[model samples]
Target: MEAGEDIRWLPRHTVPDDLVFPFGGKDWWLIDDRLLAMGHTEAGRVTGHEIIDAPKGSHEAVALRNALWPLAIPHGEYRP
Candidate 1:
């Protein structure tokens, strides 16, 4: 999405959920109970993707990556 674009989204949960603050950068929070989504138009095409959970805080981004560097999410591994 770009500036001036209107993003429409909804939370995954009906009731308010926990507030997850970003470990770095900003202090935004993510709702634990609600699934999130946003819609936007790009190059004349409308597309959107679901918001997902990031592993807690990314405070140890480098360390986490180094520790699990060998592991990978195989294609279709988590698909229904």
Candidate 2:
């Protein structure tokens, strides 16, 4: 997904055991085949957008956020 794109992860209590793809600059939601909330992330503030559901107790819930943390800001900010 490009910068400033909003997204929602399906399934409020379970983690989807697979890779997710939130492509394009358009906002999208990542839902499992059963249409449940997992996790979500956006480039900017999600005004008026509510993160309905997410993994209740799994580390994978932060997978996308952890991965995207590097891209949150510009280079040299987190450099050693």
Candidate 3:
């Protein structure tokens, strides 16, 4: 993760109200908004990783990225 640049964590309760819990069955990494790496976890361990191409300029992707900013709490600044 890049300091103050490449990583962000949004508190659980601060997630968008319209979004559902367990966002997905796996963890995801959006790289440069062009590739998405999905990590499959089992028993608290990462079991596998798969990468998929993504369209960064798409309306949906742009919208999601925009919406996430307001909900994010800088790392080490969250209290819960």
Put down candidate 2 lDDT per residue, 24-65, tens digits, no spaces: 223433344223332334566554433434444223435555
lDDT string for model 3 (44-77, tens) is 9989998867464233444665678777776667
Kindly report which residue stretches of model 1 are placed more than 4 angstroms away from their true locations once superposed: 1-59, 74-80
**Prediction-by-prediction clash tally:** 3, 7, 0
With a 3 Å backbone cut-off (N, CA, C), the pairs that clash in candidate 2 are 9-37, 9-38, 10-36, 10-37, 10-38, 11-36, 11-37
User: What's the candidate order when arranged by decreasing lDDT?
Assistant: 3, 2, 1
TM of each candidate vs. truth: 0.20, 0.25, 0.63
State candidate 2's TM-score. Answer: 0.25
Candidate with the greatest lDDT versus the true structure? 3
**Residue-level lDDT for 13 in candidate 1:** 40
**Deviating ranges (above 4 Å) for candidate 2:** 1-48, 56-61, 74-80
Relative to the true structure, candidate 1 has a C-alpha RMSD (angstroms) of: 14.6
lDDT of each: 0.35, 0.40, 0.63
Worst 10-residue lDDT window, candidate 2: 31-40
